[model samples]
Target: MFSRLANVFKGIFSLFIKDMERKNPEALLELEQENLRKQIANFNQGLAAHAGLAERLMSQVRKQETEERELHARTTAHLRAGNKSAAAQNALRLQSLARELEENRRQLAQAEETYQNLTKAREVAVNAARSKIEALKGAINDMRMKTAMAEMNEMAAGMVSTIGGSGDTLSRLHEMVEEERTKAAGRARMARDSMDMSEVNIKEAEMDALADQALAEFAAKEGIALPGAEASVAPEANRSMGSNPQSESQ
Candidate 1:
């Protein structure tokens, strides 16, 4: 049971750390970059030590070459002077110097090669790490943009559903409005149909005609030419008005 509890806690901690990493990947990236820098620094320190060894070996090789040349000159001079024992001693020393010179040259070559390889390896590793880090930075930005777009899509989807519900209410309102408008139009049509205007129109026409007749007679009696009256109608109206008194007597 205790082990199970510990495992559960560990799982929770792992999940929490994963969540944190996701939320702040840049921080993790910075930490990794710093670690890379430290590693490079350490590697460079070791490389510096190797370089010092190479330099020392180069110096030894130069010194051995110089000693070999001096010993050869001394051995030749002793032989020319007829000092056989001294010449033999110089020859032996020259032989020893030759061997040492050869070995030092070989060691110098190896040290120089190792130093070059270490330097090149460090450069390649650093470049690769920087490239990967830059790529990771771009990936993180893209992830953030995609995550934002996903959230926006979810919000829009939620809004669409909410607005869809409101759309039903709006549709109902429109239907109610249309029904009321149709009812109002029907009521107006019915009221119009129920109205009787034929007799009223005839009465109004008769009154208008009478008023025109009175005006025509007054114009005829006064001998005034009325505007918009037919010339023949005015003379006929005067003759009729002049006969009205006689007709009333009869």
Candidate 2:
């Protein structure tokens, strides 16, 4: 039972971690990038150790070659001096040096090859990881943009529905505006119909007569012949002559 409970708790924790990873993919990607860097550093350290070994082996081979050359020269000199024992001993030592040199060369060659392989492996792994990280970054940006667009589209759709809904605020506002406009127009028409025009017409006629009298007086003062004044005087003279016989008969 305790084991089962532990398993359940582990499952819950795992689920929570997975949820966090899903929600924060960039964080997870950054973590993976950091791990990749650490792994590469560790691999490089190992490669450096292997490269040091190869260098040591190469140094050993060179040292043995130098010793072999010296031994060969010594053996030749001893033989020429009729010292067979020393020459033989030197030859034996040279043979052993040759074998050791050959072995060191083989190990050096293998180490160099192993180092190259590790280098290539590191390059391939790092390249693959960088490509995946870049791809994930692009995908995250695209997801964020698409998510924002989806939210905007949803909001726009909601606004459209709300604005177009029957008896909504916008509709009521339009109705109220139209009703007020119609009432205002009706009130304007009623006011126009109710206004008395007789006084206005009388005032307008008086203003016209005053203007004409002012014009006649100005024309007379300027000694300007006025055709309108002459016309008016002729009409008054005709009316006086026609009314003289009526006044005598009365």
Candidate 3:
């Protein structure tokens, strides 16, 4: 029972972690990138150690080669000096050195090949990981942009639905404005129709007569005959002449 409960708790924890990873993919990607860096550092350290081994092997091979040459010269010199025992011993030592040099050379070759292969493997793995990280970054950005656009579209759709619905605030406002405008126009028409024009016309005519009298007096004082005065005087003069003839005849 305890084991089962522990398993259940572990499962819950795993689920929570997975959910967090899903929600914050960039964080997870950064974590992976950091892990990749650490792995690369460790791998490089190991590669350095391997390179050091190869260098040691190379040094050993070179040293053995030099020793082999020196022994050969010593053996030849001993034979020329008629010391058979010294020559034989030097020849035997040279043979052993040759064998050891050959083995070191082979080991060096193998180590060099192994180092190259390891370097290539590291490059391939790191490149693959970096490419995946970049791809994920692009995908995450695209997702965020798409999500924002979707939210905006949904908000716009909601606004359109609300504004276009009947009996909404804008519709009521429009109706109220039209009703008030019609009422105002009706009131104006009624006011215009209720006005009495007879009194106003009489007053207007009196003002016009007063203005004409003032103009005529001004023209007489200035000794400038008005056109209206000339017309009236000519008609009066003709009437008087006709009356004089009548009176003479009578």
Listing every candidate in turn, what is its Cα RMSD in Å to the true structure after a full C-alpha superposition?
A: 6.1, 5.3, 4.0
Better model by TM-score: candidate 2 vs candidate 3:
2
Lowest summed lDDT over 10 consecutive residues: which window, candidate 3? 163-172
Clashes of each: 0, 0, 0
RMSD of 3: 4.0
Residue 140 of model 2, lDDT score: 96
TM-scores, each model vs. reference: 0.70, 0.80, 0.79
Judging by lDDT against the true structure, name the best candidate: 3
Q: Write the per-residue lDDT of candidate 2 for residues 1-250, one digit (tens) a residue.
A: 9999999999999999999998898899899889988998999999999999989999988988899899999999999999999999999998988898899999989999999999999899889989988999999999989989999999999999999999699899999999999999999999999999999999999999999889988998999979877887899999999999999999
List, residue by residue over 85-153, the lDDT tens digit for candidate 1: 999999999998898888888888998898889999999999999999999999999999999999999
Candidate 2 yields a Cα-based lDDT of: 0.93
Ranking by lDDT: 3, 2, 1
TM-score of 3: 0.79
CA displacement after TM-score superposition, residue 113 of candidate 1 (Å): 1.3
